[model samples]
Target: MLEIGGVSVEDHLWGGRIMVDLPLACWVILLLEYLDTFRLEVELIWPAKWGLVKLLYVLDRFLPFVILPFVGFYNITANPSSDFCRILFAIPCMGIIACIFIAEAILYLRVFALSGRSRTILVVILINGIVVVATCCALLARYIALATWDIPRPPGVSGCKGTFTDGKLVMIGYGTTLYSGILVAVLCVYFGIRLYWSRRPGRIITIFYRDGTMYFIALSVMSITNVVIAANLPTGFRFLMAPFQGVLTSSLSIRMVLRLRQGAREDMGLTTVKVPDIEFTPETSGIAMDVPRTRLGA
Candidate 1:
């Protein structure tokens, strides 16, 4: 039994197992969600015309497979060279950024549509995205550059853990994501409230606010939890929430898109049309007549 500092080497290996477990859990979620939602994608997305929304959906839906493998490798592979760890770490982080960008783009598009396709709102979304991407990139770059890793995991344990100059810095990069979600939430509420007061909000409008509110709240809670834990907890556990939060963000973002597309199809397909004077039909009350003027999807 070997001991490093007062802790047994086995205890240190346990930490490596935890890192593997976190990402492994995320792998389960990713697969389950894909199988669960594939039918919906076929019904809603596959037949639809090629457009920005579909592209974003396709990327967000499939990107995880590409990213998660690297993440898994980083955690489960036996002690790897420091150079290899840096490369593996960079790949997953870049993949995460790309996937997140795609998801956020979907949300931004919904917000843009709700704003009646306002150019001003478009500019705001662009600026917000630029800020978020730049901030996260800078922080990520700084941490990777300053990170150091010389210690090797015990023979039985597996991981490519890098000791950060300040582990909290990595979590800080994640916390920056909250800024994007908050701005989107604010835009949603601002435009959403106006629409609510001005008229009987249509199905599309309701979906925009509904999905927006839920998505923002979920991400906000997850981000804050990550930041809090990272700030207060030991550096080893700093990334305890990353996989959980990442899976959640992807899941919520994709659901929002699917719901909107479904709403658009429902409103447009005229499943039940209501005519005031010429009433009396089947057992249906007829679909409401206040659907948004613009198409709800890209």
Candidate 2:
């Protein structure tokens, strides 16, 4: 039996040798709840897009919650062997993977909309998704194989298997994570350069100041966190995935809220086109008129 934070892994057995923790189950539920809340808000304000994309995001946000609990309960009641438990766990893991891809899709769409460019962003997202999916599949397959073959469980846990030991899976996951991090960095640099080059003399402020920098920064931070988690891939990494996913989803929902609020402000004629200390030049061709500020209420 293994212990983590006073929780015992004694009773649980998977594949005739591995033990699963109750805390991990609880953590998954909490993450699902957070994602559900965020998804509800996003659904209310999701931008008009192709029908299939909309459908996918809706399913991505809701399906995990619906599926995970059933699998968890089934595993708990059945007390299945490690092989069976690993198979059951694959369901939720795949669901989470789907959600991550959905998030990447949303980000790609938003970038395309903002830049008015097509195909490039879509291709990038597609490539990233393929890599991520392939990596996850390899990981799941290896895990199942190991459990079925009765490989010795990692030390300190009777029946717990290491999910990140597969080198191909590790490389794939880390590659995607690193790619995301680099993409975010590039975007930030591009925006910063745009902001600098567009400075106009004498003009204190311009509507371009309202670009959604907060949203960009939030995404960048989340991407960096994902990279870190992927790089580490420690035994506890899975536990951190849910919370980071929740935060990322929440940030996206917040951006949606800000967009709606900006629209309302425009309708009410409360949006000033000028700011006292900012300026814009003709070179600022692609700057958004609705730049989201930290103090949006002001």
Instruction: Kindly list the per-residue Cα lDDT of model 2 for residues 1-298, writing each as its tens digit.
Output: 5543233444334322211243345446546655655543443335333355456556555555564453334334432455555655566556555555565555444444334454675576577667666776666556446533233433444322333343345345535644663564465356445544555411111222233344455555655665566466543343344334533543353344334433444433343432211112224333234433423334
Q: Least accurate stretch of 10 residues (summed lDDT) in model 2?
A: 201-210
Question: How far in Å is the alpha carbon of 214 misplaced in model 1?
Answer: 1.3
Residue ranges of candidate 1 with Cα displaced over 4 Å: 1-8, 152-157, 270-298
Summarize candidate 1's per-residue lDDT along 57-105 as a digit string, tens digits: 8888888777777877876677688888888888877677677667778
Q: Which structure among the candidates has the greatest lDDT? A: 1
- Please give the lDDT score at residue 34 for candidate 1: 84
| Whole-model Cα lDDT of every candidate shown, in order | 0.71, 0.45
How far off is residue 134 in model 2, in Å?
A: 3.3
TM agreement with the true structure for every prediction: 0.84, 0.54
Q: Which stretches of candidate 2 lie over 4 Å from their true place?
A: 1-53, 67-75, 149-175, 188-247, 250-298
Per-candidate clashes, comma-separated? 0, 15
